[model samples]
Target: MHLPPPSEHTMVRTERVARRVFSRLNLALLLTGALAGCGGPMEPAPSALEPEGAQDVQAQALTYPSGSSQTVVSRRVVFRNGSGAYQAAAGFEHFRAAGAFDIALHNIRIAEVDAPATREALVLMSAGQKISSSGHSSGVTGQASNWDASCDSVSCPNVSLDGRSLAMKLRALGLFPSGKTYLSVVNDANFDHLFDSDTKQRIVNGFSNWLQAQVRPETRAIYLAGSSRGGCLMMRMAQALRANTALDGIDIYVSSFDGVCRNSQGELGTFDSKINNPVRPWGTFYGAWATNLTAQFPRRDRLHIFHVVGGQEVAPATGIRAFSGYAGSTPPSTGTNLDWGWYKQTWVKWQHKEIGNPYTDPSASDQAQAVAETVDAHLTWLDARLP
Candidate 1:
């Protein structure tokens, strides 16, 4: 026989009891997880610094992409950090197990809009003159060997250095997430093959696109890095970025290695010497970053700027040389919190022969590799300063 329906008051009372019991069960589960060193997904892991902003969002596993996809993530990006409006793109690289560790762009090309997108970014600008190339194609994690940035084309603008090695190193250190950190390079697409106004504007425009396209509420941190001529570009880019409103809330980190830059007047003279191309000189569009930055940020610690060079990088020879003397008239480089130099710091040659073997080789030394490690450490320390 069917039981009589319960009274309304009795049913209400029963529901209240059920709610209390469920709450207790939830608490028990939470306690169990904590005991096992597993915080609930909603809770960020204990961190000395501010936790990642997008850590609570669920995402798909990082898989290889099939094509060139550099679609930008639509978001409200401003121009508080730099000159032009923020912009960026991405392409996916799905390297097979057999894929070499060379200059291949690797998985997650900015080109693949369909591939997974991450709020955290690792952007790398290559040296001047050299375009994109397949770098250090045949290598694996945990093993050290020779590495090279073999570009896709012989022509400079046609090639760009791959950032797989840099990304890999960051990932191993837990600063960048696996498959989430989107690495990129913003070249002066319209350079008359020289670092002039046209090239500077082009780079600024590309970055504006990148900044506006790739950011979302999920975005947490952005790390911008460059080597040699690229370092100079990164500096100018960062200077311009300071004016962009898009970078207002996001954390930004910019680093340079053996970089060369134009003086306050947009001149690339040799430590106040003659210029290579007297027609025009490309600069930060504002002033020398090493000097002007001190006025821009003031706090010094608030600005996340890094510079690493090799002692072998001598004067009047490379960008680092230019950078070293950039402040010959000034003192205590601006925003350069982790300034360092090494002996065996040959640049273009190092990229060709000492890709994976930086610190080990005598001529190449371990400068680049050591600098990378320093970047990771510096980033972690910076994180600690955040809210």
Candidate 2:
């Protein structure tokens, strides 16, 4: 049976580039900061509607190599070390609690999505401005769901969009190793600053810290899934892990669903003319990053990167639609916007949100079926990469 429709706030295209003004901080600046240390005073931002017992946290400043600093803020939880490394921090002891699920010190939500019969694990980063809700019926008796009781409507939970449904489906079909597999959901935390450079940086840092702490070299496999903006963040985190010589030779897989990237000023574009243009900072950052990855990774079996797109989610040639980047236009026939040319592509006959979270828009039964099929296809593509 279908679940209730999500709140209107959930339906809004949170992926749309927010036009709000903020200080300039580009990708280069962020990378510089990651290499440097945190400094400067932080500006206070509103707290997320976090789960109960969540604390009102303060934002942390990260100093970059450029001598400029950006304030990285998280309403629900503030990382002890804003530098984004895997370090022991206060209030982090709960992650080792004697149970299948526990909130890590960085405020990451970890749960056993699958039966711990195997050591493989999946890490998920949901699209921007979304939260975990109750799972819809799977129509299969004794089927497990992706629901987490700790998720509250008031707070932005760490669970990704449609994360529960995906885990349940993968488990039922044996696509995911059911034995001892953990699902770590990383939170974006600040939808209010959805397109801000610091907001996105927080996600990248959180995932990277969690990965460094959780995934051991002996771990058999690691699967990463990201939707919308998260897709880019996942790749960024993977790139960092690859550079870390200590975690050498471990298998890593990435699945990107309609991934899009924005610039420091919260602008987006898919066309090369727009992206590569010096004035259009939005598309330029995305274009350069995608191009770099394509050249370095070359889509090898070990690198396992897959990209899926909603057939209808084409952006305008101008690419800078204030509210919906994918609206008001069609993709250029010249192939300019296909940033990740190396990725094996899968196309789904749905819109952006539908493909990202099929359980959304509960207006038609066929939509549900189509979502199920799309998710099945994505999982199958990922499963084939499993050793």
Candidate 3:
């Protein structure tokens, strides 16, 4: 969610949270760079072998019957790198049985953009350089292994060592061999440094970049979903697709978890006023990020957007506020709510912010259920619109 220039009160609160999150993040990045420079000093990689009685949850591989025309295909479609655009092999599996086709599973890479700027920020941060704005860094963290999960479960989950996890739970049941399903897993901070390159490029590109790649002639119906930054990317991509008219015949269904949105009013706010202050670091970070993403799609009315936020989650609370308070007219005023009305008329659908974190909080089971229900509703709409 993007915010305009903050009010005095809002700026003060935002500065505090921004400092805290950015400080720790900057330190972590510096430490990582230091260890890399030390070569042979860092610890060895962890063994995949599990300890005794570790509740072995084997990574289940996609299964297919032999001698059948039905085939499961998997690939990672790569786009931009620091040097230029390139296609990477995405791990995808196509399943066909009884004359039916379905995308059993696939992994998409979210590579970092503008590597030079990222490197400069890292160097300055490591050398104790202080900047007015918090340098760009991955928001969520966890091990890469966390993201390497089996698709058998409804919640097909993935995570990086830094604690950032992408957990998508699709509600559709009874898989058909001929039916098609699109599952997109976005790695927000999947970084790979090639030969001492300064910038760390994310493995999975953001939604905007990804959509630009898929707008090719070969692309067909798409079921898109993302969490956090990915969610912001998804929303912007939908807008782009709609405006371009390139996706006119394509059927699309998009969803986000704890995702942020750009508000029309451009003021900093929280999703839940009662639970959160007017401004926080999350709001600022998303504000900045969403601004960058939305700026790419000038005409945002082209695609239908479905958004969901947890009332309890800090990010969505701010998002909710931005949505409700969006001012569509010039000389924006506090009482004017333009985006709210436009959202109701368009495909913008929002649910109550009840679900906390889909990955961490068990209490948010109900919220998770709501998300699944919403996806089902979207799919129903999509099926009717496409084919």
In terms of lDDT, the best-performing candidate is: 2
Kindly report which residue stretches of model 3 are placed more than 4 angstroms away from their true locations once superposed: 1-145, 148-182, 187-220, 243-245, 261-302, 311-387
- Where's the lowest-lDDT run of ten residues in candidate 3? 120-129
TM-score of 3: 0.37
Better by lDDT, candidate 2 or 1: 2
lDDT for predicted candidate 1 compared with the true structure? 0.36
Q: Using TM-score as the measure, name the better of candidate 2 and candidate 3.
A: 2
| TM-score ranking, best first | 2, 1, 3
Per-model TM values vs. the true structure: 0.46, 0.51, 0.37
Best by TM-score: 2
State the TM-score for model 2.
Answer: 0.51
Each prediction's whole-model lDDT (CA): 0.36, 0.40, 0.30
Cα displacement (Å) at residue 375, model 3: 5.3
